[model samples]
Target: MSSLREKLKTLEELQQIDLDSNEVRAELETLPAKRAEIDQRVAEARRAYDEEKSRVEGNERERRQLESLLAMERDKVKKWEGRLGEIRTPREYAALSREIDIAKKTNDGQSEQIKALVASAGELQKTLEGKADALAEREEANEAELKGLEERQAAAQQRLAELDARRAEAVKRVDPGLLSKYENIKRRRAGVAVAQVIGMTCDGCHRHIPPQLAITLQRANSIETCPNCHRIIYAAEAVNPPAPPPA
Candidate 1:
């Protein structure tokens, strides 16, 4: 059992703790930071995908142009070959042969270009496909995690509301001076200000109380402070633990 003053003190501290433990605020505080991080990652992944797509598109366009040029060169070479079989004079034959050679050279250049373009398109398409697949997977993972976090946030908010209601009821019964003292101590002691005294032990610090002091503590109506931890002490059986159950 705690003294009236000590009980009120503990109640006030518990209330303060509940006030500070606003789950909604905590969740809100982290939301922007989380969103910023996720947004950056998503943007980066998307940019990479877009760049890959553009590369593939550009390669395809170049490949198509190269193919068209190759076809035109092949047709010119065929026409030149036919013209060569009908030539009679040396000058005419020489001029016709030169024209045919030019056509052959053009066809060779166009064919090489087409082969290079085709290879580039193949590589670009493969790389683009891989990036797109990775982006899709990453987006799905983010969405799933976001959903889970949101659920956790909602549950935490509901739990906090319940705690706040209890805290409000508890605070109404506490004395102002006791409440003030509890808050002051709690600020320095990680939310703990008053602890139960169990026999000769200070529960706050787990240190044994001097024999004389422990006797005085059990008899005193005034709030007693633990010498070791400076916490207000109360003689509560729960804190002092009774002897173990009989064997």
Candidate 2:
């Protein structure tokens, strides 16, 4: 029969591999969402730039329309002024004066509209320039961040594969019966099938182990389970210990 102590040691090694693999797996699962978040930021930045660009373009078009209307109004005023001398009746003279006045007022209003549009367009242009610069910088930074994240993801994936291979090898070194028991307990106990006995305490539950059982665990010859957590218990010094200081 395989020594229970040696079997437990193998189990401990296997458990460590599982723990390491689990961490890498968890990181891999979260990476996609992280990448998506970065992508969303980039998309929002681009949308902002496009919106500003559209505003500036719309202002320019409106300014052009206002200029065209102003020209038409000025032409009407000039024609009416030329016709003022030809007016004979007092009513006709009054009608000609009213037309000229209306045309001049319209021209002045259109000039003011054009002026406001030009000023607004100038501000919009400056805003668009700043946004473009900001967008460019953000895109560059996000690209670098994404590249680094992808590299880390790749490395984590590779590490998981290595851990899996190591776990397979480690499992083979343990007895089949013990491995079966460990797997069953691991499923029921949050992936921790083994626990270490520290002094007289079960590390799994921080509960005190019976004095006799503690002695047996210290002997490193028999397998034992913690009464509180039922996890396989092994001596802490057997698995790891603080290295002694240089003499």
Question: What's the lDDT for residue 161 in model 1?
Answer: 78
What is candidate 1's lDDT per residue for 97-161, written digit by digit as tens? 89888878877887888788788888888899999998898798778777877787787777777
Clashing pairs in 1: 198-240
Please report, in order, the local distance difference test score of every candidate based on alpha carbons: 0.74, 0.87
Taking the tens digit of each residue's C-alpha lDDT, what string does model 2 give over 8-69?
77888988898788889999999999999989988998999999999999999999998988
Overall local distance difference test of candidate 1:
0.74
Model 1, residue 121: distance off in Å is 2.1
Question: TM-scores for all candidates?
Answer: 0.67, 0.91
C-alpha RMSD of each candidate structure in angstroms: 5.0, 2.5
Q: Model 2, 213: alpha-carbon shift in Å?
A: 1.8
In candidate 1, how many Å is residue 134 off? 2.9
Model 1 poorest ten-residue lDDT run:
4-13
